[model samples]
Target: MKTQNQFQLFKERRFLPYFFVQFFGALNDNIFKNALLTLIAFGAFNQETRELLTNLGALLFILPFFLFSALAGQLADKYKKAHIIRYIKFVEILIMGCATIAFWHHQLALLFVILFFMGSHSAFFAPVKYSILPQYLERDELVGGNGLVEMGTFVAILLGTILGILLIRIHTSTLFISIAIMLTAVLGFMTSLWIPNQKTISNPDLKINWEPFSQTWYVLKRAASQRTIFLTILGISWFWFFGSVIITQLYNYNQDILHGNEAVMILMISILSIGIGLGSLSCEKLSRHKVEIGLVPFGSIGLTLITIDLSFAHGLYPEQVINVSTFLSHWEGWHILIDLFFFGIFGGLYSVPLYVLLQSRTEEKERSQMIAANSVLNALFMVVASLFSIALLTLGLSIPQLFLVIGFCNLAVTMYLYKLLPEFLMRFIAWLLINCIYRVKITGIENIPEEGPAIITCNHVSLVDPIVVMASCHRPIRFVMDHQIFKIPLLKFVFQTAGCIPVASEKENPEIKERAFALVKEALDRGELIGLFPEGSLTSNGNIQQFRKGLERILNNNPVPVVPMAVQGLWGSFFSRRYGKAMLHWPRQFLFSKIGLQITKPIPPEEFNLEELKNITQNLRGDWE
Candidate 1:
């Protein structure tokens, strides 16, 4: 199978139409929102009142998500998502039309009401928008699809904000701004009409729970039942909170800190949005077209470091910069912009994997509800971010200092999460090991079952074979390794996090050997994959060794399918025994040596010949080692 580039998704109907619908919808939203803010800023009002109304506008917009996301999730679960998208888009057109009248009449109350309704439109659309992708696209396509969606959204928001702010500055700004938002809404509805209907509702029997509070709690509880899913939700919410703080402060940061005008604000927004878009799109390639959570930790680290850099990027410049030119002229201003851009890039890396993981792992029936729950948490976090910023700024923290706090807070939260759930960190280590040490080429990867219990039998060629295989497979596997390998100082933490099974010979440690077998049975019973290297020890001369009877014992008890895998090209590498002892090496091949993993079709339980299994592995690894 070929890996599809994320951009290729735009050529298809299932993705392209919805992508436009989202793009136009988000564009309209920001156009109206920014237009309102621009009015408040330049209107005849004091700074305090302007700030109050601006914050109020934000609150009103977010209120509907908290109030209506549960109902939206239920609607998505019980009804076809395409129909729901159409309804939401239709509502958006009406809301934007009414918003146009409000803009013309300068009716603050009506516009605020429309803003709440617009938020409701987005809230209702959120669950359906995401949950429908897996229904239409293949499992491998999900990462690319999500990346495109996220990248499109940020770009639309950037363009919308720039247009909103620029147009609202004109003398007859009302007509132009009104036309833009109204047209975008109409276009969004038209595009939504082209979205194909889902085959059926995910949970047709799932009753609609109208009460937001109780329904919200109910959905959240169901979603939280799975620890990893719940933590993934938290990770996504944290990203929103961090983003909210950064984007919210950009206005003031441009004016007060950077001493620049609205145009400079546009530049900052542009750079940040572009960075996120690139980062989001990069996820598909970086993850090798799979749902790799390692990118999450990598992304979080990038976000924290970049934001810290932004906090310290402040300067004691005395000039009153007027536009983008003056702003870009100073190295300090460029420093800030560069930070914002990279902040976006890492933010993209951080968020896209999480959304993919959430969508792919959740059950089809409860997927929308879980997404709704995520939406609820996201809104709550964003609200708290606004309040958090307000509180900090009021407590005499400069905006740059606020960014500093946001960075450290992100670091603290991610570290806590990694402790609670180490999969993110574990995957990060494996990804790093694979990328740095070897270029792994996997063949017949499709032969690996997508689910259920299975036994993986591979020839152990190196000390890091488990990590290499773990990184290649999409699902997590509880690898069975020699107890001695577990004692390695640098890798012990990762091994523990991954729940690796350590086995010793019965003579060396009977208790550990017995416990290893028990754990193997337990893991298989729970429908988990268990990895075993049946040769019993690493080959010193790069040759397959005699098969161990342990494989026979495990299969007898469990009767699970046995998959044969061959790991090649590590014979003389640093992790192989060709250099004295493994890891005590001088020189070998160049870094990133080609490592081939050939996994054959699984053998049925009745055909339980250990010699045949070894022969198949040898064939797959022929002439390589």
Candidate 2:
């Protein structure tokens, strides 16, 4: 089946209703929270008490996720997600009713209680909302669906914050805020009703853990059982920590560093939010509709570099309040904005993939539990970040230095993760090379086995052929490469990390050829897939070269199902020798070129032959250039 862009999912019944449900939920959340902040800031409380109350307000809202997420996760896994969502919305309406009453009477006590309940409501809803995506959308649509959800959420935050500010400044401020919160809750409930039912994936008889501390520990243990899941959760939490520190300091950054007022702060926020939205939406296209973890590292690099630059850029602006118009008129302001924009871009790139990875990898029964664990850890990380920032600032570190330290810390963390998980970096290089030069469309990817050993045989089209094929494959591939080309400078590192087996013509290097064959045999024996370019080298012309006999030798030893794959639209590219010596020619016509990889049904071991594989690959790659 052909893959569809993420936006197309919106037209389907499965995604649209849920999108609105989430959108409205986030809108109501930010509306109430921001409104509370405004009131506490401007209300009769003294300045010292106001700071305490505002911090308390933030804590109350986040505390529920810490206290109740374990229970929420259990309910989400044990019952229909749609049902849980509807019931949660019903609870939200009640919470908003309390909020309305508190606002009407201007009772600080009841308002704090309402805030705590709102936080609780969000905590319960968290696992259900995230875990429900994998249930409703196809695997290919995960990134896109997540992108839209994130974008919608941020947009809601932006709009809701603005609305709350406007409401509190009005003549009948209390009345307007009360009515807005209630009406939004009702609308959210209405949308939740339209969300399609998603049946529970966990056991109905599973015991519900009511003890938050022990249950939370149990939940975390379950997540840790899956190493990648646990690491990614940590990764996600780290992003939150990094982001919270940055955002919290932005208020100070606006006043002390940028020498700007609230208007300049808004400008910074707008640029960052817009950048994230764009970055998130672009993931589907950048990843070619797959959950490419490579983007995670790619994003981390951007995050580090841009953050470092931001530290330098902030120093260029003088410490005096600059109007928004004047801030834009200066190059220093533009530099700061650029840094913030790319920071959001990399942040989006960092987050979207990991979230999709969690959804795609977690067992359906434990998915909600896993998400709840993530929520709890994320909250913990943010809280820790606040304390860390305060300590750093107290130690005489300027805001810019704090950013610099975070950036340096980010580099250290990412490098450690990459060393632990080389797959991340390998995939990053593959994704980077492919996306930087070519737009690839892959079809029949499902024809490859989801698990277990299989042989993938494709026609060689360019020096970068293996990288392209690697990027397209969902599972890691052990490619067999010519020893000479395998030793090429920078490409050697990527090839070595990817586990490419180096071979030479038996006449020239008999021992190396034997070792290559032996390695392929062992990989297949271990239930791992090996990708081979049957034509054995880059195509000198724009046509498929004849297959070599290496496949026959490998299959003779270990008979395995062989998938015939093909690459088209790369013959004349700079990497291919179609124009002249590959890599020597400047990329005049190859920049931003589109390419395609097509896979046909697997040929049984009993039916496979060298000549037959060649014909099949050629036909699959038909008539491109």
Candidate 3:
């Protein structure tokens, strides 16, 4: 099914009300937290007490995610998510009401108590916010849905923070801030009332553990049971850690490096947030509304590069405080802003897909627990990140130096993840090639099985046939490519990481050919998908070459179902020989060139034959040649 733009989701009732509820929830949280921080910072407390209170306030908010997330996950799993959200929002109204009294009477202790409750509110809401999406959206809508949620979250945060800062500067700061928080909470509760109810995925009769420590352990153990899910959780945590480090240091980065005042700080934050919003929105377009892990590496790489650039981009301006307008007047200011913008853009790219992956891959019954686990780890990582930043600064590392270290560390961490899950790297390459070079449209993708062994045979029309097929298919596919093409320097890494089988003609390397067949059989026997081009090589003429016997050999040995797919519009692509030699002549269009892929029903191994497979693929190609 064709995907609607992420924005279009707002027009539908299923998503719009939920979006407003979440938006207002985040908005209120930031408004209250930032106002409290600002009050403590500029209020009448002594330097020691003020600093202690400020830090404690931040810690107070994060503490609940650690202590209450297990229970929160349990409730979300056990109850209808939308209903839970309404109850949570009602609690938020009560909490904000208490906050109003606290702020009105200037009761610091009471305000601190309210802060903890607010954190608790967020902790409970976290699991429900993410896990409910799968119940609300289609599998294909996960990416776009997540992107919109993330974008909305950050944008709301930005606006909330701005409002907090502006409102807190008023003469009756406390009263104004209190009114704002209470109003937002009431609005959030009203929005929650409009959210449609969704069925809980967890067992209704499932036992609930009331002990926080034991329940947290139980949830953590469950998360660790699934290796892929656990790694994805870790990936999400690392991104939080990485992003937090940069954000925490930005205040210092602005003061010490950019030598900017408050307005300049806001300007930098606006650029960063806008960049993230844009990058998050772009993920759906890039992934074709699919959960594409390829963007994870792509995003991580860009984040690292941009961070390194930011590290260098600083220290160029004069060490004198300037307002946003004055800072913008300088060329050096634009440089710094550009780096900040891209840093956020890449950060968004790195994060949204993994969130979608976590949502889509986990079983419905346990999904909330998985999200709670993610929140717990995310909090841990952020705490560690705070300590790391302090340690780095204590070591006399400059802010720019800190960024440089983070950049290199990101490179190391992503490489490790790529090593851990080569599928992520495979999808990254395929996503990059398809998005950058060609516009690929996939049809009949449902023909591929959602699980179990299947051999997908496509006519080899271009060098990039495997990539296009990989990007389109929901499941990861091990491709069988010519040994020489597999050995090509840059392309080799992609193929090897994707676990592609390298084959040679029997006359050239019979041993390697035999091993390739063995790998294909092994993959099939394991119920994994394997892709092959029956033509053995890319077509020299824009016509289907005679089918090879390799498919016959594989089906005979493993007898897995065979899926025949065809690439139609690639005959004249730059990767194809319809021009001169592929890639040698550069006379074709650069971007948005149309390409098409069509898949036929899976042929049972007993019914599969070389001639029949070839005919179906050719017919699917039709007039595109």
* Highest-scoring model, TM-score: 1
- Per-residue alpha-carbon lDDT of candidate 2 for residues 1-625, written as tens digits (9 for 90 to 100): 2238888877877888899989889989988876777676556776445545655676677778888889999998888889999999999999998888888888888888988999899999999989999889888889999999988887777767667756876779888898889888999999888987764456476788888999999999989888889999988988988887786566556756677755676678778878888889999988877889999998999999999899888646665668889898888889999998999889889999999998998988888999999999987887777677767776788889999999998899889988876778989989877777788888898898877889998888788888999888877899998998899896887898889999999798999999999999999999999999887888787788778888998889998899999888888777778778888988756566888899989988999878888888878998985
Put down candidate 3 lDDT per residue, 111-170, tens digits, no spaces: 889889999999999999999888888787888888888899889888887777668778
Candidate 1 per-residue C-alpha lDDT over 1-625 given as tens digits, one digit per residue, 9 for 90 to 100: 3236877777888889999999998888888888887777667876556656766777788878878888999999898999989989988888888988988898978988988998998999899888998998888888999999999999999999999999888889889988898889889989988998876779999878787899999988998899999999999999988888888677767666777778888888899999999999999988877899999999999999999999989786655657778776779888988898899989999999999999999999989999999999999998888788778877888888999999999999999999999999999999987777678889988888889999988998888888888898888889888999988998888888888999999899999999999999999999999999999989888899999999999989999999899988888888899878988878587778888899999999999799999899999999998
| Candidate number of the best lDDT | 1
| TM-score of each predicted structure versus truth | 0.97, 0.87, 0.89
lDDT of 2 at 174: 88
Backbone clash count, each prediction separately:
0, 0, 1
lDDT of 2: 0.84
Error in Å for residue 566 of model 2: 3.0
Candidate 1, superposed: residue stretches over 4 Å from native: 1-3, 44-50, 319-321, 587-590
